[model samples]
Target: MFDLIVLSVFNGLIYGLLLFMLSSGLTLIFSMMGVLNFAHASVYMAGAYFAYSLTPYLGFWGALIAAPFLAGLVGAAVERFGLRHVHGHGHVAELLFTFGLAYLIEEFVHLVWGRNPLDQRPPPLLDFPLFTFAGIDFPAFKVFMIVVALGMFVALWLILTRTRIGLIVQAALTHPHTVGNLGHDVPTVFTLVFATGSALAGLAGVMGGIHLVTNPGMAQALGPIVFVVIVVGGLGSLAGALIASILIGLLQTFAIAVDASLADFLRLFGLQVTRATPGWEVWSITLAQIGPMLPYLLLVLMLMLRPRGLLGSRDS
Candidate 1:
């Protein structure tokens, strides 16, 4: 049981870190531009579909290289054309525009990829198990996922902290007017940040497509969950996003791995309730049944208790 718990925690950490990859970009864009990108997850879905189409001809690695570039280009175009035009309309308009873009992307994906789940698999090299502990096997693909996520995290940290570009980005996030006064092209910086964020989403989509099933509805399915992560992690705070993502990931993983029921609680208290008894249904609740809602539940609790989020400077 202890081993199982450890394994579940590890798996959760992997998922959370992947989520952070997507959320970090989002938080940065939000901090710098003050826009909540509703279409971010849709771009992620596009990455998956783009990879799927590319895999038949170019293979997984090729798709991995090309899909994110294409997605980033798309993001840049959207910012240059669509967002730039809409920026004058205020924050609500910007958000609505993104929401509309999300809907359009969903429909476009259905039209192009069809309204069905596509079978996506990792490269043949990643098909086997990496190792086993306490008689439980861990797949090589999952290990690869952890490595890739960690590498991205380290690279991103270095770029944001060590380079001139990173310094400019940080300044833009906190003092955009000052940066602009100093002759930096603030709009250009914003566009680049938006594109970079989209690229990160694309990377997550490609990895998730290989790990999870890909379908036309995948965007809509995961969209709210990502939003919850952003809100729970605190708006515009990358560190908060990292913490929230891992917290939600582990909470869900452990919730599903455990098997205890609410009935166990009643028994411990020397109380009993029949199936037909009023309020007795609580006794029938199982961990698995509630596991899926764990993230949302955490989001609600966090919002209620700390509106600014764990590390956020402002309310989401």
Candidate 2:
């Protein structure tokens, strides 16, 4: 049990950090642009695909550096050519545009990479086991992932809190018009933020592809969950996003570890639910079986009780 607990916590942290990688960019984008980009995960997918294509020629390390920049360029193009045209139509138009963009990106990926999952293995150098504990072998790649995630977080914090551009970004978040009046090119700033956000998503994709399956469906699978992280954390709230991601990740991981069922609960109440029981099928459902449902359940509860999220700004 001790070993299981330790392993689960480690796994949860890994998953949570990955979630943060994906969510942080979205939160930043929303803070600066005041619009949610539904296709953010698609950009993540593009990154993975780009990496897959580049790895053959550039190798994993080279692809790691190149793919995200390519994805960022794509995102910049979308903002410059596509989203810029739709800004006049209001937020709804922007939302729909991104929703459509997600579909288009998926289709484009399918057209190029096909619907099949790509064989995205980590670099051979980092493919070995880091350590063995309690019959569990911790992979070097996961440790690398943790390091990468922590590094990204630190760099992001430094950029947002310690740099001149970070100060400008913070100012623009609260006073875009005033900042523009002060002679800052707000439109260029917006484009840069979008590109940076997309670049982060692409970085997530590159790492995530190594950990999970990379396919055309990857974006579709992860898109909604990423939204849940930010929404539950709070829109435009980086701290909130981080907290929510870890909370959800740990909860989901622990929930899957539980083997108890409704029948087990009923037993403590002096009841026995068997195959012959009226709702035996429902009562037999184990926590592991319903683990995936927990996030939505938590999301609903959070929305009902605290719509602004844990660390969300009141004005945002």
TM-scores of all predicted structures: 0.94, 0.95
lDDT of 2 by residue, 34-126 (tens): 788999999999999999999999999999989999989988999999998999899999999999999999999999999889888989999
- Lowest lDDT 10-residue stretch of candidate 1: 272-281
Per-model lDDT: 0.85, 0.88
**lDDT per residue as tens, model 1, 38-122:** 8998999999999999999999999987888888998899999999899988999999999999999999998998998999999
Q: How far out, in Å, is residue 209 in model 2?
A: 1.0
Q: Residue 146 in candidate 1 has what lDDT?
A: 81
Tell me, by TM-score, which candidate is best: 2
Cα lDDT, model 1, residue 311: 82
